[model samples]
Target: MTSAAPVATESGVPLRKPRIGLLGIMQALYDHMIPGITERQSGYAREIADRLADVADWTVGRPVKDRTDAEEVMREFVNADLDGVMVVLLTYGPAMRVARLFNENRLPVLLANIQPEPQVTAAWDMADMTYNQGIHGAQDTANAMVRADRSFEVITDDWRAPEFAERVDRWARSARAITAWKSLKVGIFGYAMNDMGDIRVDENALLRALGPEISFVAPGDLYRGSLEVPGAEVDALIAWENARFEVDPDLTAAEREDHARMQLAIEKILVERGYRAYSTHFDAIGEDGRFRRLPLAAASSLMAKGYGYGAEGDALAAAMVYAGHQLIGEGHFTEMYAMDFPSDSILMSHMGEGNWRVARDDEPVRLIHRELGIGRLEAPPTFLFRYRPGPATLACLVSLGGERFRLVVAEGEVLDAAPLPQLEMPYGQFRPDSGVRACMDGWLAAGGPHHQVLNVGRHAEDWRVFCRSSGIEFVQV
Candidate 1:
């Protein structure tokens, strides 16, 4: 079985390479009238396919000249698990040859409005027309797709241009993200935090809108799993943590072992059950004496391993964080705790968890034990660090109503600042592109929720493409 982990960069940004089908279209009548036209067009199709192979896992088909050829190519694409289809109009083929196939199929379509020649001069003749008239065919197919209400994008440019390849890459990534969203599975360890209206969602409505299947995990399962964790596993985890983090002297060896046990148990259950993301509620941790302390450290460690986490049972936030990680690479669940007018920044922090992998390289992540003020539990070991300073994007997914959702996004910068030792949690300061005040006002107007996924990159355009492909309302601040 393939591991569920995404392909990421050194800094942990996910690059979702998509699988697509590339089919070239041409008119059979022209092939008979001009003996070499089909061969020349096929060569262009081959070159374009080769150029795009690095961006996607492309299954290239021979040039389609008639209805029979179109049907055969369509069958191949339908049989395979493809994210989308890339249709190249080599010359003017009838729209009916492939328009109905696209209308009936569910995969997203990208129309390549390109020709063999980049320019048409006084030297242009009938022979050149037979090979370089694909633009009209692209327009014909695009019109039919629009009439049929199909989701398609047209790229009209020289195939060798950088922008053309970039657009194709963007569409491929967006299509892959859409596929990932449709099959996402999130384990809900506890119910949503009470009275948190913004974080609560209707499961059925959420499934219909975003396609994440929710599964409730009983507390007894975690309890059993924790007890079953071997002593060697716990010891290895503690040693790993000690080697990677600045361990606090105040934390006892027993406390470290207990934290490692909880982390191991969480990892085992999530991996065994194939969960992409999860949420935890402090109130549910020790309710039945199943846990000695809250498993606060697991959240950070799992996130570093590419699992999404949301605190206080915010499953919507969890799903968004997972998607952000898969779409961009570094995703941390956070809330805007305070506004600093002097610096025009918002203090972003979470309760006790973050993707520790995104911590600034200048400082080591500190492992410290902290008490839960609300629960009758022992102090839990968690990581404390500041996010790396860089360009960032804040994204929140919220329900608008039944079967409807919206994605609110803001482009910002994580300011370069010293870590606040007083705040014993993962934290960072973010300054929005439009300044803090204007951004906050716009965010509120768009119904942006408190819990959000903070990622280290300028990925607002990526989010926009994802939202467009997934049928979600996108509001940018």
Candidate 2:
């Protein structure tokens, strides 16, 4: 099952580009340090900050010289709400003070072990050598963080190196994504599909490990809200879908309106609750019979508008989708639907609900009947389309007991799902870079869950950095 065209919903989450702030700090002794050499060292620190501006949105803070100055700089960072802080050490200074400040504030730290000069020149003198030397300072800072049991990253290279700037930008992106996750709200409607142990998560453990808060939404709220939606609103949604997609004539007008009403009600519920993502069990929602319509349209539409939607009450997957979307720009909620050994590919899909934004632009989704009642003629409307083929990554964030989670990721190439006459659902065909048999065996060995978030680009590196920065286990499949 799929969904209708995207709508301009008022409650949609606002997408913001990640911003990274830079801080330059030097450890200088008031009386012992050479004044002229320290001044040149600070100049080098400023240059590093200036170069970083070409890669990311950064604010270079005033260089700190002591513990008191470090605390003050951290205060400024908090006030500015910087995503991550890059500490550029000018000389061997107070590593313990910087580590304490970063730990207390719980900010992601990137230690810039950047040297002022790419290499030692023949004309270099004592002052020039000392000014360019920051390696020991970075080492000291890293040692301090490790002793404090804090997580941090190190980047050591010349400031002028393109690779150096790129690495900094990637860290910035990961940090920004982590910052966004602190206040994530995931709403769970209905119950988890019965007997899916892998999808079941300990709520307290999840909250303690990741900052996202989960809440339950009653089915009655959605059912009543859908019924109360004005006919004009539903008609407007249908008209919007009609203009954008090629709706199959087989679907009755009432079916389309039914989907529209459900979609609008869900949007209102999530918006009113300030939820950025949601999970639901279609079976449980309709079990009472008053609301038999599965929220296929709701799930797909919400995903397109930057909201994560997980089928079968998989709240973890929902949050994972949102995180990937923030870090990767676009992520589709999917599962291993089937294996096509002959084609050396895996058919990935779900019962319904996928990010339509990831669908192929060349092939628009078709309105299809979701015949879930076995032999019933009455069914809801859903979308069916092939996802855009390209390089992609599949990831699953699985729980590993109290306050522990592991990220399972695999890199692959996304291929177009062939249009077989019997295939009626939206899907993306993926060929794992590791080959089908090896990927399948490794995935099963790792106990990867049935559900995952598929992203358009290869983000295994980003995810690895993110997991490390966030203090989660990362297991590559």
Candidate with best lDDT: 1
TM-score between model 2 and native: 0.92
- List clashing residue pairs in candidate 2: 27-93
Model 1 residue pairs with clashes: 13-329, 14-329
lDDT score of model 1?
Answer: 0.82
Q: Which stretches of candidate 2 lie over 4 Å from their true place?
A: 1-6, 9-14, 30-50, 374-378
- Write model 1 residue lDDT over 348-420, tens digit each, in one string: 9977888887788899899997766655888888789998999999999978889788999999999997668
For 176-236, candidate 2 gives per-residue lDDT tens digits of 7788777788988877788988888888778777777778888888888888787777877
Each candidate: what lDDT?
0.82, 0.78
